[model samples]
Target: MDTRNKKRLGAMLLTGIVSLSAIASGCGNNAADDANAGANEQPANAATENAVAGAGMKDGKYDPPITITYLRPWGPDVKFKDGENQDNNVHAKWASEKLGIELKNQWISPSTNNAFETKLRLSLATNEPMPDIISYRGDFNLVRELIDSGRFVDAGELFDKYASETWKKAMDEDPSVWYPYMQDGKRIGIPILDYAYNGDPVMWIREDWMKKLGLSAPKTLDDLEKVMDAFANQDPDGNGKKDTYGLAIGFKNWINTWMSDAGWIFGAFGTMSNQWNLSADGKLEYGSVTPGAKQALATLQDWMGKGYLPTEAGLYDETKAAEDFTAGKAGIVVGPHWMPAWPLEDVKKNNKDAQYKAYPVPSGPNGQAGRHGTSNANGVVLINKDMAHPEAFFTYQNYLFDQFANPPIGGEFEYGLAEGYDWVMVDGKPTTDAAHTGGFAPEKYTITFDGARIPGLNMATLAKLADGGEAATPFEKKLKLSTPQTMLDAAKIVLEQKDITMQQLFTGAPTATMQMNNDILAKMEKDTFSQIIYGKAPIDSFDAFVEKWKASGGDQITREVNEWYQSVSGGQ
Candidate 1:
């Protein structure tokens, strides 16, 4: 392989160079040495070799300055207190001073969802130059179309080549991360791995009412009934007046949808509402119209008749229902752990005597209490086909994962973005309760978007919800700020109830017909389920809905889902 060895055999073996190049393909060849011997070496990637030179890092803070063109689906009025520019925010600013990278807004507006898609498609259609990077986080239909356009590069190899160990570990934790971008043997974009259990709804109750009413914590459906009965009739507030309802459940799109869904009650009855799933026999089944749902509906109807459920529940969203519970007008509500930071916090502030606690969804018939939820599936960095610097993306991402995401020693995560921007030492302490003029925006991720102090929502906020502790940093200490007593209580219940958690992880892409007729099928399902719940139709009417659902493209959707599974699994 050396020049001297090659020269000894070269007079009649001029083809040796071709064989050596093939042998050196796996490991890197020394380009300089090869070029000195008249071997051709390309000069296009020379810029990538020097990409990290001007990047920022000093002590623990990212120094220097680097800018990125970022895009996300947000309208102009999408509120940011510390934001001055349409494109950049505190997060991007922190990335500049802390990570030495700045994010410039390439384009932003109300059209982020549809407008972004149209813009991207038109650019591709017109053969316009693409940006340095595109982080696609929109509808899957567009993602699938992007792959077909062949304008993006495969990110899988680059990830293996340059991704930091911390980021790699994150990817390794879930193989499902590769689902969206893979086509045959090619991968066009990096799958964004968001947090799990965004839909794990837990039960919250007023501990103050429990103590005042001589009531014990409910552990089963029967016990829950008794508790609800008490909340309906007994003046639990001890004012000798009946003013509260047993539960503040809402029926809006948000209530029955992912994350804030109240479908846990259906799980008790052996049904899962609003999910497309495959059962033990491998056939796709809709859980909403089954006999189990009938049982669940019966229980709900009885509660409604007993005045245990608020009449306004049919009209409330999680926010409004939470407002009712926090205002002491309802005894129970269901939500995720972050509830403590928002509506639940308002409840605690409204009444100092209002003590609340979280509990698992009560056990149902057959002694099972189940809930439906799943991890997030989007928001990763994607590469354009003509983008010159894949290494630059990896280098910047490596620092983010190593320095911000994964904490070793000398980690700045505990301090938030920086001491002066988002946090400050007031007489030598970090305080969110106090005010700092133009200091880092007091609001956490709920506030900023430009560069963002948050690495990702699922990574930062949701991770903290899981690792809440009495011993937290100025960063970690935020977990203890002003969460309502109810949300903290509900999280405890969720920890215990996690055993029955189920997610339809393999639901896959919507079928061609589903993509076209889902609106119709969804409306049918909603109308049928609503009628059954309201007694406008007998439980037997569910049979008609089932037959009609199958006829209306649901069957085709199931097969397409199966086909996608086989495709992604390589027909495993």
Candidate 2:
């Protein structure tokens, strides 16, 4: 998942605002002293040739240390050691000492209140000299704006020429990761990758409830309904009150969301709401208007009528919806494999005997089972076209990708970023405990918020562990030491059903029509879906809503989406 979404989820868990929008505002020219300083010191062509020839290094270090300037977005979650700041952190020191690269922050802005985005947009608007590297994790529009400014280089060329083979292979695993950063047949930015399938849904059921009710794993919709009935009716919690529900879900935001997701319900019916899906004719279509959505809505109506969900489920957001299950009022919730480490863990705190496990999502009536898939790319790293050392950024990132990301056993970073920060030696053994380490997150200090991650390595490693494979690699050993058995089991289930995961086909910025009318269309879809599920509207009303949606803006949006898709995909 992207750092933006990760921050949002963290805020939500801490009872902060669940949604945050970047606000464009004026910013001071604090970066004037640092902007393009290095570029002016050398000829552009000469610098480019030198950078390429030397691969930004001479004997594993830049002969004369090169400076790389950056603009950073600092958030409340970003902590520092007693006398360190973003510009003078452990990561900066390491880069300077090891790579002979002077990492400097041109300016720092708060990410929480959109100051960073405001500053970046201001730089674009004012034609300010750009920083050497811009690691943006905010709005895609801002990224497109940066690309459109014509100040960035074709990163694809540099990546091809300089990226480590390991890093290139990781990026090659999902070519679509470049879609959002493409401009005029040039890859303008390099994607900041994360674990793939990190957000894909899995069925999380209370194993204790299942065992208490003597119910087997639900393999299909009919079997799931029986289990739901038992969970709602029987005293699985042994309180003898009909206060519990069968399933926990929320539609206050969208059917498909990061937490307490209900996308699998529509997925089971062969569609996913609130996204663009590839149709049989190879065109993008709005998923909410697909015929399968009608059936999914009907099923939700049936579940609602049977008292299988919370009365206020329509008003609950992701965190609010998960509360019911965490509070022991619901038995089943669909979410990613990480749920066991979070909201699901709270269930055990509420009841020490609460035992939850991940299961494959039940199939629909026609044996179709599907769910939302996660995008491998999170944010992006864009470089200034006029930078004196374009390869320096890649050199720094490549080292992270090859060594720090999945450290070799007995390597420098095999334990963590630095001893006494993310890991510490305690009793002759290294442990990653907050109490001993002071919970310092040195990775957050890196240019890329979470450093580098291979998109497919995480879940693949977990799945291998689940399949009785040895923890052979350092990455595998890290997972074995930190990840719970339940999550490993869930990873295997996610991999087993990878074929059915429906990733959003369109990955570009919003089209003109979408920018203008998406709010109206989204509200229309949400209201209609919620009404139909709550019996406020008839099932047939969905058909009328679909027609109205197309007439209003959806039809044009679909065409524009496909046009954008064809442009990025080369008409594939």
lDDT of 1 by residue, 298-329 (tens): 77767777898877766775556667888888
Native-referenced Cα lDDT, model 2: 0.78
Give each model a TM-score.
0.76, 0.91
Each prediction's whole-model lDDT (CA): 0.56, 0.78
Q: What is the lDDT of residue 571 in candidate 1?
A: 47
Worst 10 residues of 2 by lDDT: 18-27
Q: After best superposition, candidate 1 residue 23: deviation in angstroms?
A: 50
Alpha-carbon lDDT of model 1: 0.56
